[model samples]
Target chain A: MEQGQTMRGADAVIKVLAAHGTTTVFGYPGGAIMPIYDALYGSEVDHLLSRHEQGAAFAALGYARASGKTGVCFATSGPGATNLVTSLADALLDSIPVVAITGQVASAVVGTDAFQEIDVLGMSLAVTKHSFMVRSIDELVPTLYKAFEVAASGRPGPVLVDIPKDIQLAEMQYQTPLQALETPVVETISNLEQAKQLIRASKAPILYVGGGVGMAGAVEQLRDFAKQTGMPSVATLKGLGAMDKENPLYLGLLGMHGSKAGNLAVQASDLLLVVGARFDDRVTGRLDSFASKAKVVHLDIDAAELGKLRAPDVAITEDLREVLPALSMTLDIEPWKAEVAALKAEHEFNYNHPGSLVFAPRMLRTLADKLPEDSVVSCDVGQHQMWVAQHMWFRRPEDHLSSSGLGTMGFGLPSGIGAQVARPDAKVVVVSGDGSIMMNIQELTTIKRRKLPVKILLLDNQKLGMVKQWQHLFFEERFSETDLSDNPDFVTLASAFDIPGKQISTAEEVEPALDEMLNSEGPYFLHVAIDDAFNVWPLVPPGASNSDMIETLEKE
Target chain B: MMIHALELELHQRPEVLERILRVARHRGFKIIKMNMRSTSDVDATMELEVDSERTVDLLSNQLTKLVDVTQCRVLSSTQTAQTASL
Candidate 1:
């Protein structure tokens, strides 16, 4: 080998990563990963400088989910690495693909009380699909290839790769793998006859699709199968944008604050074909009553997910992209389409306002209508998210972005940064609750520095609305410690970042506020005050059937 | 035919996940899983269902002493196998 051709461990890591087609990475630089940063300088990978390590991880996640590829992110040792745990857990739960790279202490200094040293691999165990540490420089390329493969394989999820300081400083041959080791599908159910027979035997068929289906690129096949079966189709919040909101057969999102029609359809259905969905609690109001009328037909890529919750009458384990087409070929649903559509129409969402003080739902609808048809909106977990899912119409698929799987509080602001980075052409907005916003408030710096147009709509209810509702329903009407009277002025907070903010109080102000934000040259933050007593509606009581939802509080 | 679990204690930090899975995938451990929780009183348990006892011991003894991790052990499953065993 030529003398100048040789490189150190960190340089090798960068070279190998570039070989794997990584162009963008989000991370922060520090003591342990300085070698990596040096290696990345003047390299192919364009690293987005993040204000915090947590924001970096989430930005990578947003990139991975939107592009359907493995997202790459980097962080320093200890706190830098630990900050990525929440985003990794979020990606793992929802099966979004990401590869988080972290630096570690030197080999000799590992066990000693080394500064900035931490076991990144240990802390992220439950949250990642797979993780690794590069002991020797020779293992760099193989480990990186494996990390990407694990992140993008069947049942996609986050994978973490930790590089030790000594390893990053070592020198070795940097040969990138020509191809990744494809993880073979473990289990499959090819008996289309069984699935078809089960579908044929049931009277009311309800299709429950989750983010898995969307991630599997089975949206078209899922819609076709639902159309052919002539069943009511409902999606989880992560599964939103999979079905058109206006489709006659579409039942809208299901679970807490899920459209009444969608939940009723699930309860009334005799046959439930839950494809690639993990019936999360937010989607299943009452676990016992979810699809009570239906004999479930579970179709998913992961074998472990099959009987995890409700037992399936027919468990067909295979890629939904492949199995769906095969099933559709054998069944004909032209005759039953109209009847299913009519049934779906009955359960549609309705929000007829009676001249209230600040109708939040209408604001969402107006935003939905006014925004560019392809604009993407992500929300933090709260009442506002449910309200948007119910009332806002998403024209394009994969347009609405919210932390549905992990339900992380501070996910919106950072993830909005990611969303903006991923699709610079599309307008990205974040609808956050007062509580949720304060969690990741530091990310405001990211927007200011990057100059990314992420319009933030902060809903200030001065309370933890969702918890308040739960306490009201199950806690004997006692509101408990959910109230939040002392809160930062959002307009002032936005001003701190040198970004403009507007204080909006009524639905009448929504359009003008949106116009001001869009027309503005820089990022804008809008704080809209909402009534505290307003509860997220259409809730299913515990252990009740999907049909039995408490739309409004029982007249006590 | 041994059902064992191990407790791996690393600096309550992130990159340790890579070290654990690296060893697992390297050694070809069939089903290795870990769960995380805030630990003030008890241990953070890392469990593995390996195919052989030698592999289990090697993993447990070698990895338990890693820098950030505090404790590593092999635990047995409480639930008896109902279906045909793997």
Candidate 2:
């Protein structure tokens, strides 16, 4: 197996993917990519043919997030390759390991403006974690394998490999995957002792957990660390599943759209242990005001992220799963527990509001309560996304999937399909806004055709709810272009695709609607008309610090 | 702000320059000047002068992490003239 064997570049591509333990791939085939598809003809790997290249890319992303493995996707050159750009950017921002393989024009006509020729490698530069344009026969095998290595390694992200048609057809002496070993990422804790000292000396310490905790498989470690240290933790949207909701020391998600207590705790803390989470702008509204009182200890696998935004008092660059338990054993903080408990009680998520208007948050909470504990909810970006984040109960990080960093709309349907494929036993649901569901509404056809049991929960406010809330709050209710009152009847739309669906408008209909969606054995769509006046609470206004997060807006 | 000079050894691959520059731009470091010399058919040496309000060690550390970059180091302050000549 260590010896080199002769094979076509296209065959080598398939071999490399299989060697990396890839069980499935999402792709669409075309002229330039014919050879690769031809090579895949007799292979045991399952290749899902999506309706669009974008859908394929997003499905791959969802598969990666759900399975905790590098997702593989393939597309032809030009439009097919270009369509993957959005998902690539989304994957890069969210740090999902996705390997996107694209076909290109023949090597001879690469720069000659050949039909369907585009510089895919050049276009994907900004979005991909790394990219390789296979120029030679020998480069194909190593490059493809390297793409997997880089995509799944430290601070995982999307990687691209563009192979010209000629190269795919070319014969090459390929080295076995075992012979070409991936460069192993060595973990080094630069300042572990110093980080422990900071954690021990603080009276009021908070664990600021992020998506990295989940990516690094450190959720258990984080829980153990928090439990032992008596440190109340607040998670980012991506960090939702990292901490158990039942844990008393666990505060709800922090930052913009965070719980009132979570933001306040971060603002009040003396020591902020930032584990696996970058201080994104959304997490720290006005940078200076966020955690201004806290001495920071930032630990991440990526060294570049250490001092990129907020400088840490102690920075430890190491895998979270390793660093967390090591530091947890050194902690002895019993005095901080009661103070954190008090803050949790003070800033609890209040579901009770004064009106009979159907609150979106309450509806989502009810749905979450009714659903199975292992249910995976894919959410599109909007008020609904924030609502789900604030209310949904997730037992694990991958249970709730959102385009958090890229804030990409139309991510729900495709991601739901991918999640269902990845976890067949778990119930898969997509929570989308009326405005957002329309972005990739066509995926409904894909869902129906694939026979995937995906439940679609549509919160229709008849407007771009989040944007409308912003316009109402920040722009004095000018309401410019945010309204979607003229939207088509979603039930009818779902019916056209032969997916069973229902529409609900009142609070009484909420439970039954959720039951219908959950009880059904196949695809179901539930469209709930929510109150347009409802906005995600505990929102840190733009340019304001996390400390200035407003729990509710004043009546107009 | 200080003018920091760094020497980087990189793989001669497509868009390598843009990727390196992107990392610098992301860190809010401004590129004052840059020169690339092909040391071999596969390897290249890049001399960069960056204007930054951060420590040179930080930038060097990040640069070295790039997949294309095999080696990166911040030169002494006296080496600014040598980079200017490049």
Candidate 3:
């Protein structure tokens, strides 16, 4: 290829993707994007055809999250682009880097209500970090490059580029633009000293870790800080695997439906070192009383997040990799550690259930213990999601993928497909509920088409368990539109996709069924049926302080 | 409600103003009066008077983060501004 050699803008799109090292993309084809699909027909870059546009974008999100690379997805105009909004919003809230390219109606007919055309740029502005409508062939290449850069840069997020059909067919000279140099991070010595002084002065300091540690690639630095200070720690939902689960001083997760020990310890702490995590409403129930006594030291990469919800005693918007190491120092907090340990011991989860019914929490714990060293668990939202977060543990932040910020229900199956594609050899499992699995249930064919050796664990309670639980407690037991007693036979459903599966309802069958699922060579589904009587315990009633958590129905 | 005036410098993009106003409105600040002028072909400046009970940083911090916003400053805040008389 010569420097000034010309090619279709569609061809330039694929070339730019290759230049950026995008090996695979997830998408579906429709009317407006045919030209780009034609260009991708025989290219070296592989494309996984998802059943729906939402699935495509979610798979891209899964791929990006698992590999720490920018995930790319494509969709056609109007309906196709509209279907992608949910996943894009998911990526935006969770801060995953995804580049979505949508084909628009030809520029000439764009404003005249052309077929399959809508105001995509206007719709995207609310969901994406930034968006562009490429009006000409000259802007196409530069916009694509900028989309990739913006998606992966500071506080990574999804970026959308809408290219008109005419531009895709028009010829353009392909030239790689010069890369922009990154600005250096400057850390002030005064801020570091003030943070150190706060840490030194506190009698009980706890590290409230979040997803930023993993996003910054600063887990090791955070761990070193924890080890040096001998501080007790707790993790947010997205921050589950950021700390070593084996650390005696690390409380599991702190929030609604959080471990009682974790919530109580946070309430008792004198100083909170909030790292890479916003004080989300879920994480901080009754904001006015959350960690009421703790003096805060907040550190994150985003300057806007520093004082957004909870103002800090010392706010440092520097790289966590640099700041964590600078702030690490030995401390004497033996009594605090002992207190946290006692809380852990007192409120430890009891796997003992009275009947032969299969306990989902214990089953998840067993699965977590049995998982291989290289495994990723993509969980959907609901009761099963909470149980997975509570019972399962991961080796790294990337290993556990959940729709933390958006709490999207259909996230598990497609994200699992993407994770499996990203890590071919790593065992990827999708933990979905009866309600959540139906949201993206069409993805089963995607697994069969690609022969991805992914595993599915469907926890079935025949109800929208989370909402039903809320209704049971808060709405006088009016379980309106929450019952799903007509759920299809899950094992037979798996067989329809040429996937082997087994249904287990009793405690006696749990272990053997799990073994069979794990041992299968191809995709396998294990559907576990449990009674809907159980609910997520230790819930802090909405707007209640963390200290006011209700342990069970009797306690409430 | 308190009244605050904001000064902003932005890169000249077709939808740049929409981006700024969207953030301001979403963050609970209502723009009561506004003015804009082209500083150059590639740059533009805007003056905005907004009314909100929330702290101005809540809006200014978010406005500063938009990709097209080059600069943002709070000019003044007043407590006695009448909402209906504006």
Candidate 4:
């Protein structure tokens, strides 16, 4: 390549991705996006073809979440682009850094109801952090750079770049644009002093952690703060691995399906040192009664989140890495710690079931204990998701990838594929339910194609367990379309994709089957049949305070 | 209903107005009146009068997050305003 060489816009798109160190992208090719796919043909950048565009985008999200790098995905116009909306929205809510490139119709035919053309930029406005429709070839390179920047910048989220067919075909001179350096925002000393004063003055202060800690790479600082303050802590669903789970004072997850000890501690706390977390409705059951006695000291990178739901006594919208270290101080509150410990002991999870049928929670706990240090658990939504959150422990926030904000059903398999692609040597596992596995089950072929050593643990209740539970409790047992009793034989289905699997229903087979799944060289699915009578316990009924959680209706 | 007036400076783009209005509507602020003029080829200024029971900071804070919005400020806010008879 010469200094002033002209290349196709599509070629420049691939070049820009390589320039940003994007080694692998997940996407599906189509009519409008064929040019970019053509450019990706022999380039250094590799593309993993997904069965569906939605799967491709979710895989990109999993890659980004796993590696802390901006994930890239590609799609064509109309249906291809529409399929990406849910994943993009998921990324936006969870604040994952992803850049989705969609190929639009030719510029002249954009608004004339052209074939395979939809208003992608217009459609993207609600789902993405920012979006661009390249009107000319000259703006192609710069727009790609900007897209990457916006995706990875402050409070990162997904960004979309819609390129018209004409722009991809046009030739343009290749030149690297000057990059702009972003100035970091520094916290004020006065705000730090004010927050410290609140922490020092309180006798029952607790640390409320969220996903932002890992997103900001401030997990170490947060751990230090928790250690120094000696404060009991409760984590949101996304905040699970930010704090060391081994810490006695760390009372696992807090919120809807949270531990009784965790929710009670929050309700009784006098001060909440909220770090990198929002007061989401799910976390704050009835906003007026949630932490009714606690004064909040909120810290996050996004200003809008500071006072979005619960107004803070001291709001610091600076990087958590700086703020957490600055506010670390030894506290003189031992009585509160003892009380929280008592609560934890009083409400510990019981694993004593009389039946011979396999127990999902107990099985998940066993699976967690057997997982190696270098393992990632990607789970789908519903009863299995909550069970994983309750039973499994993670080494870091990246080690546990669940669609926290969106709670999308078909997230586990594709995300597991992306995680395996990102960390080739890691023991990546997908924990999905009978209802969720079928959503993106086509990706089993992806694992076979790559021969990736990813493991699948499918818990089969033969029904949409979560929905059926809700129907029993709230809707008078008028179960509406939640049954999945006729589910296909999962082992046979996996075998069709050249992946070996086994099905087990007895409690006696749990341990050996888990060991078999974990030790297998290639992909293996372990489908365990469980009773639908089991439901996620300790649920904070809708519109009720977190402290008013329904313990359980039917005893196992 | 409460009436609030806001002043905003935005980057000149084809869809900047749509972005601002969409955010305002989504955040529970209704645009009652709006005036806009180009400050330059690349910049535009808008004065928006909105009606909402929610506080002005809620709308201003969200509006400030938009990439196209350069600056957003609350000009005035008044409670006890009657609903517009449009």
lDDT tens per residue, model 4, A194-289 = 998999999999999999999999999989888888999999989999999888999999999999999999999999999889998889999999
Measured with DockQ on alpha carbons, how good is candidate 3? 0.72
Which model, 2 or 3, shows the larger lDDT? 3
Per-candidate iRMSD: 11.1, 2.3, 0.8, 0.8
lDDT of 2 by residue, A331-392 (tens): 55556677778878987777786665577888888888887866899999999999899998
Instruction: Please report the candidate that would top DockQ against the real structure.
Output: 4
Per-residue lDDT of model 3, residues A1-556, tens digit only: 3466699999999988988889999999998899999999999789999999999999999999888999999999999999999999999999999999999999999989999999999898889999999989998888999999989888999999999999999998898887778866654634999999999998989899999999999999989899989999989988989999878888888999888999999899899999999999999999999999999999988888988899899998888889999999999888998999999999999999778999999999999999999999999999999999898999999999999999999999999999999999888999999999999999999999999999999999999999999999899999899999999999999999999888889998988888888888989999999989988887999989999998898432
- Model 1: runs farther than 4 Å from truth? A1-5, A178-189, A329-348, A554-556, B1-86
Residue A10 C-alpha lDDT in model 4: 97
Candidate 3: where are CA atoms >4 Å away?
A182-190, A554-556, B81-86
Error of 1 at B74 (Å): 19
TM-score of 3: 0.98
TM-score of each: 0.84, 0.95, 0.98, 0.98
Q: Rank the candidates by lDDT, best first.
A: 3, 4, 2, 1
Q: How does residue A389 of candidate 2 score in lDDT?
A: 92
| lDDT for predicted candidate 1 compared with the true structure | 0.76
Docking class of 4: medium
